[model samples]
Target: MCRIAGIFDPVAENLQQRIEGMRDAMHRGGPDSAGVFVHPQLPLALGHRRLSLIDLSEAGHQPMIDAELTIIFNGEIYNYLELRSTLKHYGHEFRTESDTEVILKAYRQWGVDAFEYFNGMFALALWDERNQQLILARDHAGIKPLYYSTDGKRLYFASEIRAFAHAGKVFEENSKWRSAFLTFGHLPEPITTLKDVVPLQKGTALIIDLPSLHIKEHRFFEWTFNGKLKQEDEAIALMRETLEQAVERHLVSDAPIGLFLSGGIDSSLLTLIASHTRKDNLHTLSIVFTEEAFSEEKYQKLIIEKTGAKHQSFLVTKAIFNQQLDDAMQAMDQPTLDGINTYFISMYAKAYGLKAVLSGLGADELFGGYPSFQQQKKMKLVEKMPESLLRGLQRMPDHRLRKLSYVGLQNSAAEYLSYRGIFTPVSVAALLETTEKEVEDDLQELSAYYPVQGLKNGNRISWLETNFYMQNQLLKDSDFMSMWHGLEIRVPFLDKEVMLMAAAMDPAIKFKKVPPKYPLVKAFENELPEAIWKRKKQGFTFPFEGWLKENEYIRPSNNAEQKLYQQFQQKKLSWGRYWCALLMNRFTPLP
Candidate 1:
């Protein structure tokens, strides 16, 4: 994994300086090496910061060029060896042992369709000097980020939005997203905090014609949960086999690799699998707490014992949290409250002398491993209730009930927000000083990532969890926070094959009411500790409820929002609500 940036300004006089500025802004993502490629004639420049994960030699350095095709890429292609073998059958020659080279050859062989064959996370920009067009593509799951902005003539793109901001002050605040941010606690896909800066959607590519500066989008993949594997046994087998394969593939790193062992169902299973599969001793890092209620040390210990893992656990006291908090938050490429836990753990990983680490991020989204999945049945019942009754439900004092005001069921995203939303539209408008209609309109744009059909129960909730919550908050947080320490965080659960296999599993087996992640637990029951699966499901989270209270930076800036903080401390409100307010107060009023 690395950082990439470029400017496609046909009229720019100082392309090198602009590209280098963006590259320097993202230097933390790739501290080992850096490279720049500027067209001799045209005023276009491509910049890269290399982390040196797969191929350690200078040959793997990016802004790679081969036969008029120039490329700058971030994220690893885990299956590059297999794809390279196949490409060689098509009579392609390789000069280096690098996935970036494989990508250049694959594009020549299959064009845009080549994306289908890649099984890893990536966000890349390819300049085909022959065709005089620039192509941009992200991975199938959007695990990697690619942000771009246009001023009607120039196109600027990067792996992080901050790269654009520092490139001679190219940043302009997009105040329109404040409504969405207040409602969702995060910006939805294709919307960034900067004006005209948007993320390139995953499973899609944009081809920019160098001459006309025209851009066209091509979607190569779209996620859907059709549940074609109806038989429980078949679904179980596929989940087991695919997960094992994903764990194996994610271990393909030239540098010292490890995993973030949360001691949750997903991470425990991955540790067990990797311990047995990896040639070297499995390394793991975990965050412990002095607060017993918040720490997962007990569960993490269970996994380490079972796997015989080389474990490193750090205790995150409020003192340490406060001391490290500034640098961690500064590492945020975009402002969001979700990544603080990740920020600390990634710092831990870097100090452990590891370059890449595995995470179990997508398992909950894929296998119905969240409370929202179990709550879907009640939501379905509510969706069938009278529209008048549903409208009245909004007046109730309960937070989730108040969100029901948006439940038309015509939009899955709208309905999902009713369960998972941070603030009700009315509440958001009052908080952000904007109209409710404006908030709703901004939220409506999320339909691009919505489920294709009217899904029921677990399937509906999973789609929303994956596309909305996972993509926007969890995955985005993982990208910037982990990369802050120059550590590449790879999620095996979000692997292309693993996602497809999990999406096709029978929901009845996958989303068993008795236990969350039933399929995942059952598939490897023999391999996992009984204590790990039988334990009540607790998410891997920092002690924010307790720690936020200890934080001086978390205080209310004004009395207008003081009641919210009081409610939070009194345990009448969720820490998320209070934390969202803190984040909003700190990051908003953007310039």
Candidate 2:
């Protein structure tokens, strides 16, 4: 994990200072090294901050150049060794064993087609001096972030939004900012707090022509649930094999690695697999709460005892939450209601001197770990009613009936918002002092951005969870929060090979062979400890229910937040709703 930034203005001023300032703004992501590349004749510059995961030598330094090609990269090319071999066979020699160099040669050898061959997480910018072109690309899963803003003929791209401040960029609030955040509890991709900046979509690249400054987008990989149907057992067997291969690929780090052992079925399965494969003892980490109800220490211990992995536990208390809140807030590149737990875990990992850790983040999204899968099936009874009758139930007292009100149309946004939305359009408008129609319009616009037209039933739900929830929120938050602590949170579940295989399976067998995660459990049920899977699944939890209400700094700052906080204290709203309400107060742009 690293940070990248660059400027593409022909009449650029103070290029050196601006690029370096932008890079340094994100220094926490990559404190190991920093560099800037500027073309002598062209109005282009690239900046990079290196975390040094792959190669621990000067050869790993980025702003890496070969012949007429210059590049700045952030994230690991996990399959660089395999790609390097292929490149060498094709008569492409390399001076360094670094992934950055491998990428440079790969891009040189295959042109834009090389991106399709890459198997790991990455956000990169390549400058072709001869062709007078620049290519900006993000990984298939959006595990790493790359944001860009365009003003007339100029372009500014960076790994973090805070970097834009260093370049003296003006920040305008996106029209959808308040509405989307309130509805989703997180900002969806291609949309940020800033009006001008948007994420380069996952699995897509922007090819910019330097001469005219025109841009053309190229999509190298897009996941579709269109694989040939397989038997339940066959799919499970292939899934296990694919996951093992993915984990082995993820473990191919020059630096030491560990797992964020959540003690859930997904993480426990990975732990068991890693234990069987590796000779050395595994390293695992988790947060333990004094409040036993919220702590998974028992299950975590079971995994530790089974694998004999070296484990570290951070005992969290209210005092620690109060002490860490402000700094963690700074780590939030974009205001998010989730990912606070990830930030704290990353901080503990960094203090323990670990550079990288594995997480089972995408396992739930890929393997139907959410109630939405079952809920979708039940909603068909409600779906039988007329559209007008459904809309009449929008104001119902029961949450399920209210969610059913959103199902009149074939809409991904409606389905996702029904399950995970933070606020209704009316509430968002009231909070932001805007019209409800405007908020409704903004929500409608999201459907076009994440259209899962071909998918159906559980497959459709999986697509929405993976692309909308995981892509826009979980992955983005995990990247900023962990990388800000200089810890690379590697997700084996989200790997290209693993995700595609999971996406291909039929929903009948893919979802709920057990309560939470079936494929992962079926893959390793024998070796994995029973306590890990037998226990009731507690989705991402923190002691925030008590901690946030007690903390002075996290309290209400505005009228809307005050009302939300009062409801929070009354036990009417979950900690997550109150948390997002808190951030809206902090991050909302002024008129």
Candidate 3:
């Protein structure tokens, strides 16, 4: 919803210019207004770029400061109204009817303990003058991103990694992260393409003590699948209720809101619920492709007819892709194989004058809607194989079948890698000019960061999908791409309360029915149109393979990239692999 940047040091001079540069780099994120706050005693400056979603007045402006604390926040607190009421009863006062103010008051009422009380996506930094320390925190689900770097002299933090360069931080290309990106199609969290720059972990808070410069981190939340089981009927009812509440809470915005309907169960269900909450002026946005195989216009129409909501559609063709591809690529602040879909969709939403929209992003990970869920069962058969044989198989030729071999030899993270990875360790080594052993070592380090601890089967797969894929790729991509167009894309399924409810669900209930997403489809079966819920699940995608042929700006140069590109031209390369190569070449060209 906004862009925030700050620099903290006890003796840095010309701090305002540095903060302003970071703020200007994120100008697209918040074109409505800009503000900069310089701390009186502490050598700190906070810069903000505002899009004006909530209050639409000067009161909602930031870097908002009171007597005790000054804060720069980038997110929405859905439960702010409720928290504000509670804080008022506790004798807290407010000047603006904005969630930004609510966060300040909440922090006043309780210290860092206030993060657990919030149930929305956020990445924020609050300078606590009273405590003589600075506190930075991210939302529980990592829906928003915060990037930071330090040189033992000054600490710089921003909403996007690109802003760091404008803030005068030089970073050499990181080979390990390049290898990781080539392997996974995106870099995992807490790692960036630049050396020494890091993403603050999700569900965690970072505190920097002012003069001493000591930093301590606290993990405020982590998603787990182990929860008390409930009866089938009871679980379904609770999921429905929780989802409805999450949708309603997301509807709390001052500007007009819309839905990105993919004509799938998740978006349709959200539209159905949102229709009940806001009957009029509920716009739904969709994209139809000239390649009919990639179009969901038919199902989009079905949902439109059922909800009777105002509809807008973008007809994407080769010309559209050609015209928009370059700009979209330039708009990317980070290198990613995905998010081109999000970038185009958010562009259309902004052109339609909608400030905020709801997207059904996290539904697949939470409800077992991906093939990885079913594949996890088959992957378990690997446990019967001998460890010596499995280790030998790791040296096998890198191919689709060979990757599947690795999936069986290990656990959920390995299975997820086989299913979701873009390149094998050998392939990444070749591409990044690194050794296969180094790539393997980087992957091993990445696996250690994976949240899949002791979860089993479907739950383990869910953990990997949510933590590895959703957290690293989907959520980060959604944030930068959408925010690039100054649009706020809200994900109700990623709501902390909703995620908690889903985590408590028995894995047995997740895909018990056909088309997967068993609990969601069953809970709303009567309400959802049969034509919509009964169809085979289709991913939200555009016709990229055809367009890639015509786009010359994405060509590869060196032997490594050229090799991958040649395979793509021969149609032997997977789209994921082609995309990975194209983006890497486009963004971080090989020197």
lDDT of 3 by residue, 280-364 (tens): 7789999888788898999999888888899999987788778888778767777778898999899999998899999999999
Instruction: Please provide TM-scores, in order, for all candidate models, with all chains considered together.
Output: 0.96, 0.96, 0.96
lDDT by residue (tens digit), candidate 1, 210-237: 8678889999998877778888888888
**Ranking of all predicted structures according to TM-score, beginning with the best and ending with the worst:** 2, 3, 1
What alpha-carbon RMSD in Å does predicted model 3 have with respect to the real structure? Answer: 2.1
Q: What is model 2's C-alpha RMSD?
A: 1.9
Candidate 3 local Cα displacement, residue 349, angstroms: 0.6
- Note the Cα lDDT for every prediction shown: 0.84, 0.83, 0.83
Q: Which segments of model 1 are wrong by more than 4 Å?
A: 384-389, 392-395, 408-410, 448-452, 569-572, 588-591
Clashes of 1: 0
Model 2 residue 70 CA deviation (Å) reads 0.6
Candidate 3: Cα lDDT at 101? 96
Candidate with the larger TM-score of 1 and 2: 2
Task: Give the CA lDDT, 0 to 100, for residue 68 in model 2.
Answer: 92
In the range 1-591, model 2's lDDT, one tens digit per residue, is 689999987777888888998999999999899999988877788999999888889988888888899999998888899999999999988888788998898888889999999999999999998888899998998888999998768889999988888775577777778778888888887678888888899899999998577899999998888756468789878988999989988887788788888888888887877887674758888899999888888888898888898889998888998898888888888877888889889999888778998899998788888888888877777778898887676566544456566676455688787777777766677788998678777877777788778778878888889988898889988998998898898999988999899878877778764745787888776787777777877876788867766678666877767787787777766677777877877863521
